[model samples]
Target: MKTFEARLKPLMIAGLDGEAQAWRAFLQLLRPALHAYFNRRQFQGDADVEDLVQDALLAIHAKRETWRRADPVTSWCFTIARYKLIDHLRKSGRAKLVPLVDDHVLLNDGVEDGAVRQDLAKLLEATPPRQRRLIEDVKLSGYSLAEAGERLGMTEGAAKVSLHRAMKTLMKRVADREH
Candidate 1:
């Protein structure tokens, strides 16, 4: 948000200029905002959320000098928060982070449908049948999560977890292939 650029940018600029008090103030203020960001994202627990907040804050501090003066401070801070979250998910051996791709991703891509479907089939081959169905319905077939869940007789939350696991399985297969 431009408001973040307006408010936090000055504090960061001052801190970069060797103004200790302003730097401390920036950290103090950024802490809560980062906390809220992690709290919303953390799937494990409160302690983990707190740990992630600390991690992001430390990363932000360590990289303060790299901040582009023209960029939004909040954007830079939240980028660190997102990476911390992805790292936590990876180290915890949980599912890969859900992608932010649009639901209609298949519609716009120029790739031929046959090739795409073949690739999708290969990637999804090892996934469980129900999970494969869920992935097809939600990710490829243009169904809402709730709709897919309903079709499969799963609760929405269960569907979400299942979809996450299916994607994780696909990612593992891809990684194994690359190696």
Candidate 2:
């Protein structure tokens, strides 16, 4: 089964090589995840979220040549999205200073960004690679279970069951960590 990076990187390369279909497919695959990211961060309305997604896409298109072939495309795309989010927040005066961090943002979300990162990193490290990938692909990357399952060569039911178990395991691990 191919990892997300494994699957996405090639399409990105083909897009760079002027494959119009692959380029559109690559952006289409990314739209859901980028939309989810902005939605979770701020909620001006659906239009605002859509604006952010389009903004990120345009930025990605403009900066397409800057991406190093050896680096992770997802990381590069999210970096651009994050900057766009920060810019939006600043312009709206909702956030004066938003620190760039991983997994969680430094917002009014009660959980400190550092703590969220620590807990997330710990839980992710404890999960098996397949389960970890499921979590990342489905939950974080906004892919449906069926979509993620197809990528991993599993049935949707199997993917759903595995993700359920993964969440349970993380809950238990979090409880044990608290103890």
Candidate 3:
């Protein structure tokens, strides 16, 4: 392990000159400690803590101007790295804290709405032009069948029949593809 003064002096001076070599030296000094810090504290599967450490070091390098030269380098480096680790924990869904409750409440939420919309878009791709137009007018755009009938120049019953048949055909096609 590199001694604190040996590790810090070069970086502090090189950082003054905004030299990349100083940035590299600083990261090498900090990485091992940051790794051990994360490993000892956070659970595994938090997206490779070493990567987070490197990210923190890079961020420190990028934001090096913010540091006061009078400040001790180790404290400044660890503080930045600690904040980065906390940020990673929050983003990775590992930092949430909820109150304990006696009553268990569960909701049966189905597939995500975004996923359903994507499936609908895919279904529309395979739909015939008339069916696609009718679905857009009635289901999607919220047009009444009577209005749709007038637009298609067909009777209300004929419009309903065509729309129903088109929906059934689409369902069958989607079902067949799934199977």
- The alpha-carbon deviation from the true structure for residue 118 of candidate 3, after best TM-score superposition, in angstroms, is 50
Ordered from best to worst TM-score, the candidate numbers read: 2, 1, 3
Best by lDDT: 2
Give the lowest summed-lDDT range of ten residues in model 1.
109-118
Candidate 2 pairs with clashing backbones: none
Pairwise lDDT winner, candidates 2 and 3:
2
Q: Summarize candidate 2's per-residue lDDT along 25-83 as a digit string, tens digits.
A: 98888888788877776586999899999999999999999999987787678768767
- Residue 32, candidate 1: alpha-carbon lDDT: 80
User: Residue 172, candidate 2: how far off, in angstroms?
Assistant: 34
The C-alpha stretches of model 3 lying farther than 4 A from their native spots are 1-6, 96-179
Instruction: Give lDDT: candidate 2, residue 62.
Output: 93
Tens-digit per-residue lDDT, 1-179, candidate 3: 66564567568768678787776776776677667655645556556677787787788778778877765566566557656765765677774332111011112211122223445667788888777888778876679998887788888898899899988877687555533
lDDT of each: 0.73, 0.77, 0.64
Q: State the displacement of the C-alpha of residue 27, model 2, in Å, after optimal TM-score superposition.
A: 0.4
